[model samples]
Target chain A: MTLWQILILASIACFALKLTGYVIPPALLTRPTPARVANLLTVALLAGLIAVQTLGQGQSLVLDARVPAILAAAGLYALKVPFIVVVAVAALVAAGIRLVT
Target chain B: MTLTPETNGAARASLAVGLATAAYGISFGALATAAGLDVWQTCFMSLVMFTGGSQFALVGVIASGGVAAGPSAIASAALLGSRNVIYALRMSPVVGSGWMKRIAAAHLTIDESVAVSTAQSTPAAQRVGFWLTGLLVFVGWNLTTLVGALIGNLIGDVSAYGLDAAAAAAFLGLLWPRLKHLQAQAVAVVAAVAAALLTPVVAPGLPVIIAAIVAVVFGLTDWLGTRTTSDTEGAPLA
Candidate 1:
């Protein structure tokens, strides 16, 4: 499929999933099992994304400036720096490392 | 004519969250274009997908594997978006009845809207919180997304500014706030390790999906024995 097709289809699918919650009987999916799994799965997917974005290159993992940039982000987050600032600092850290090395 | 203090508080909180979330649109905009999406495609995604996590997931996949990885990109995005289903379930009653209202509410049923609405004390305030936050975020996100895409188009090399690292940091920031529980921490560790290890062997987008499956298994089995009912209750805004 073309990018446009994927975009339209995925958006439709996402919207349908959202609508399903309202139309379906709440009891059918309100169980503890599905809810628990969904929560954990969300976190896990995000964790996986962090790893992939930072370390993965093509089909392989490579160490790069993203690693330290992520660390810098974590540190700024620990300090309760705002989200935009955290992102900017990470970019600066990565760019500085790239420039020096 | 005027809102009660409580209602005002909810509205204020909603706007704060909306603005905070909208700030990420610039990153999404820049990164989407960098991932090979044109400016309009990136803006369309912000307008249509309208979910921060899913939008980032799609662009992230494309960034790594290019457009040919469209299937995985969609899957990853849809998977991330599945959380909105949970939000919709929680929000159904809050939205009351009316087909038109439900349709519009479903579109607005995102993390910030749900969070702000549920935090309110009264039903009227809840409605205000939900709609205000949702609309504010939608407008702000799209506007900033256009800004980011335009900047991305003008910038010759995204990597020169370390936007790649910025993307990774953005995900890390989203994940960081959810690391309160030990079980969640365990899942993060295992999933990160598994994804890193599998990236080389598996197809580009498959590793994250596999990691999600791993999460489901761990979540269902209560592998770490730290799972509790409370842990599944709330999700922070993305």
Candidate 2:
């Protein structure tokens, strides 16, 4: 498909995702079962996205700088550094590693 | 009408975060241009997909030669974006009025806006922060994307200068702040490991889905544990 087609399709899909929750009754959202399920689903979805970005590569795994970057990010986060600093540190470290080795 | 402290704070925080996020849109635009998309296409993605992950995924996929690179790239992006739906749900209670407002809210409901808004102590702050962050990011991201795309077209090969790191770094920037809690840390570790393990085996984005499942399971169990104990007090369980 063309770029426009892709954009249109993707846009539609995103809007649909956003709209689905809105259209659902607010009462349904407040219900215990749905609320619990939604919480789980959110966590799961985030995990999946992080995994795919960090790990998956062109339908396969490379496990290069991204791995180390993630580790560094985690470490910085553990140390309680600010978000921007952690990300910059990780990127710098990854870039250094890539430059050196 | 007088503005409460919460509303005032929300407005300020939103502006700060939105502006910060918008600055990164330049990087995205530059990256997209380097990947071979025209300025309009890049802007289109910014306007339509709007989500950073999906936009990056789309550009990456297109750069590598469309679906030949991997169909899962798009799917993975979509999955990653799934979290926003939850954020919107939570936000609906606070900022769910008016058709125009709702549409605008949905567009602005990103991780930064949600976290900042939720972190605020009071309702007014939450409302202010949410809208401010949303509007600022929306405007900033689009403008930056345009600038980056234009610059990228002129610069060529941004990877050589480490431009590629910007997006990943931006993502890390977003994820870092939430690590304050032990649960958040645990979830990050579990998700990262899961992603690493599955990336090589599954489709490009499937690993994310798998990791998400793991996180959901952990979160659910934790929720259940908390709920069971809270029930003892004869209070409504969250």
Highest-DockQ candidate: 1
| Candidate 2 CAPRI assessment class | acceptable
Q: How accurate is candidate 2 locally (lDDT)?
A: 0.61
- Candidate 1 lDDT over residue span B3-68, tens digit each: 898789888988898888888888888888888889989999988878888888888988898768
- How far off is residue A92 in model 2, in Å? 5.4
By TM-score, the best candidate is: 1
Worst 10 residues of 1 chain B by lDDT: B227-236
- How well does candidate 1 match the true structure in TM-score terms? 0.95
User: Which lDDT tens digits does candidate 2 get at residues A16-95?
Assistant: 66665555666655444444434444344444444555544556656666667767776776776654465456656766
Model 2 Cα lDDT, one tens digit per residue, B29-71: 8768876778998898787778775676566545434544345
User: What TM-score would each prediction reach against the true structure?
Assistant: 0.95, 0.73
Model 1, A1-101: lDDT tens per residue?
78887788778878888898889877777766777677777788889999999998899899989899999999999998987888889989999999999
Clashing pairs in 1: none
